[model samples]
Target: MKTLLIVDDEPRTRQGVKKTLEAWSAGRLRIETAASGVEALEWMEENPTHLIITDVRMPELGGLQMLERMSQAPTKPVVIVISGHAEFEYAHKALQLGVVEYLLKPLDKTKLIHSVEKALELEEDRLRIGRMEKLLDPKLLEAGQVEAKYGQHVRDAIAYIEGHLQDPIGMKQVADHLHMNASYFSVLFKEQTGMTFSDYLTRKRLQRAKELLAQTRMPIWEVAEKIGYQTAKYFIKVFKDSESVSPTQYRQQVSDPEETIK
Candidate 1:
């Protein structure tokens, strides 16, 4: 069962969140609460939690400061921030910090529940992927014989690309990491993955961007930056070239209830 930690100063808010999540979790989750950021941090350090839902304002340490401190922890727990302040600056900073969601106070029960559900789903997906990677690592290592001796190297390259897809990754950089010539590495990557390295990277980035677009109300520019495109124009051009539709159009289409139902 996954553990959830709720951090809020108000007793009413804390009880409200606990009751909501307990119901949403369907008795399959463990719930814990802390009255302030300091207490939350201490509890988190002492106990393992899969998700944290915290308020932006507290008596001692604010949510942003707590988030910054949590970033340095060995286990990176998923975080959702709720604030009464709807200032653009607060939302922007929360997004920049990679928070799963920045919700407004006087929380809508449905929205809050949905956000927690999504965060838990993402956590499960990540754990499953990690397990699959562990199982696949040995097979990849064994595949280097009778084919290309650099097969494992190519696999490493792909893993590296996946991990750093949200950052700038060029063919030359990948080749340098593998200590091989760019021309040879490019050929090897294509032969191994059945797609050009650049294509793979772009596809991965686009997939990630798509998920963010579907799940969050983040601006296109922020989404572009998160997926490693510095220029929103270029990002949109590439996305359109690949999907044959603009990002906004794609998002709208996916978000339409009738279209989704159909």
Candidate 2:
């Protein structure tokens, strides 16, 4: 079972969140509670925790400070920070701490659950990759057989996808760029990358959209358009489907709270 820690000064919040997470995980997690960040760190010294859900403004050794201490460790736990205050400083500090999500309280159950699920999924991917690397030569993995796995057309298609992510390009356009039939290119891409052309393109666009959202205080519509989204509404829906949060919410979780974003 994966270990998860809940840190909050409030007794009710600590118990309530613990219960909600227990119900959501259905016994998949070994959940523990701490009344303060100091207490949390004390317990963590003897335990291995995969995730932490912490309140930002505890009396002594606040969540961010606890995270700063954790950062010096060999491995860092995935963290989700919750605060009653949406002060720019808290959000900014949480982002600097590499928090998985920053939530404003009173917590929404759906949002909390979605955030936890995403954090765990990412942790799983990290651990899986770590294990694979442990079992292989690091240099060989760094050299990456992924390129050797792809055909020249697929590589060119990937290059095209990366270059034209800001453009409203489609599979037909990309296939025509390589002077190949659309149907042939589609099959080749799927066989090579194990993902459909549309899926690959969407993934890349969303990745760029995330970076832009986090790094720049751009409006949602502009961010969407820059990633080939024609409309903000459609982009919001697609982003929420993949990320379990709207673009606005994701931006809120990651961006500078002092700077208002449209």
Q: Give the count of colliding residue pairs in each prediction.
A: 0, 0
**Which 10-residue window in model 1 sums to the lowest lDDT?**
131-140
Error of 1 at 55 (Å): 0.3
Clash pairs for candidate 1: none
Q: What is the TM-score of each candidate against the true structure?
A: 0.53, 0.54
- Candidate 1 shows a clash count of 0
For lDDT, the strongest prediction is 2
lDDT per residue (tens digit) for residues 131-152 in model 2: 3332343322332358577888
Give me the overall lDDT of model 1.
0.80
Off by over 4 Å in 2: 139-262
Error of 2 at 53 (Å): 0.2
Model 2 score (lDDT): 0.84
Instruction: Candidate 2: give the clashing pairs.
Output: none
- Taken over the whole model, the C-alpha lDDT of each candidate is 0.80, 0.84
